[model samples]
Target: MPTEFQKRAGVFVGLVTCLLLPMWRSELYCYTVLCCFILGGTLEYWTAVYSRVSSLQDWAVYLILFMVWVLPTMAALHIYGGVIGHTRLVECLIIQLVVGDSAQLIVGRSIGRHHVCVKLSPKKTLEGYVGGFVLTFMYGALVHGWSPLNISVVYVFGCIGDLYFSGIKRRLGIKDYSRILSSHGGLLDRIDSFMFAANALVWKAFFFSPE
Candidate 1:
């Protein structure tokens, strides 16, 4: 197993490549990469739950398939259509996924005294959450000029989504979702927060757009 530093480095490198390559490439490339992520994440989630819950395996498979796969794909399609009229939406999403989550992990490990949810994720702390929000919001504001409301919405929902999946893993009694990403866990482990944040972004574009 890789050390904590090694794991963090691995995740950072992978996130940068996956996020920037498609963004700098083309819309079709972005769509293809997003689709692949959604599919892989769905499979990872399903696999994580399969052996743990024998009685609900069938239903869990379908539910994760929809939540992890279908929903994200739909949101990606909307984001791709220039819903926000800015290609920076993809960059913002990546910021939320990479910076926010990474900050939480690093800060939580360094000086995380107050546990946010000891049962679901023992290592999580209030300080870590705050650090993540600050870092994520600053980066988003600089890169995409995201409003306060946008930053708050995505941060809150992303944390919620991450905790929700953490609860699932706790229930299943698994350390990581899968070994697909080595020390980083599974694809779902990486993008679980993005799934929920993407949904919120889609809703914001549709129902709350000033245009």
Candidate 2:
């Protein structure tokens, strides 16, 4: 029961992922994939944000903020040659983004109990947020290493990032960004969590991590 866009995107993602995982040895491999995701994510966000705007100042401000915001986040996630040379850091974040958001939405819609933001996204509940956090926290335990502090920070930021963009949806006066995906909204609609999650993880890994 997939929409045409979802079906196409799903197949393409599967194909690319299958091919890309093996070539993770190359820095270019992971960078290319993450770059596509960032571009797509930013585009969806831009579309959602700009769709309702009628003012030039609003458009200019949003454009500048997006470039200022998203690109730097993607750059931070790219693990180059060094300790993380062979690490599939960027891919790991993207994977979690796919799984984490999808699972949270399913849970939130079906049985979520507490409300995240009753005004912006009434569907988001505390249970869904908790559920998503628990899932991603476990993943972060593995991905962010054994540091308790790092794991906590990553979880908090990931959830906050999702909520942050939800505000953008409210500002733009739209729901789901677009109807392109049957279950999902748009690319940015989905990857908003990754936007902040990746930056938080990178920051923790470099500066805030335990010695």
The TM-score leader among the candidates is 1
lDDT of 2 by residue, 1-211 (tens): 7764475468449745664454466676666766776777767777666667779998987777677567667567554333234353544454456546655766676788778677767788888877766766666567545355655555567677877777777777777766565556776765677667667666555664422
Backbone clashes per model, in order? 0, 2
- TM-score, one value per model: 0.84, 0.72
lDDT per residue for candidate 1 within 36-132, as digits (tens), equals 8777877876787667666666566547645654665466565645665335456656667877888788887888889978898788899999988
Segments in model 1 whose C-alpha atoms lie over 4 Å from true places: 1-6, 56-80
User: How far is 204's C-alpha from truth in model 2 (Å)?
Assistant: 2.4
lDDT of 2 at 117: 78
> Which stretches of candidate 2 lie above 4 Å from their native place?
1-26, 48-50, 77-95, 106-110, 139-146, 178-182
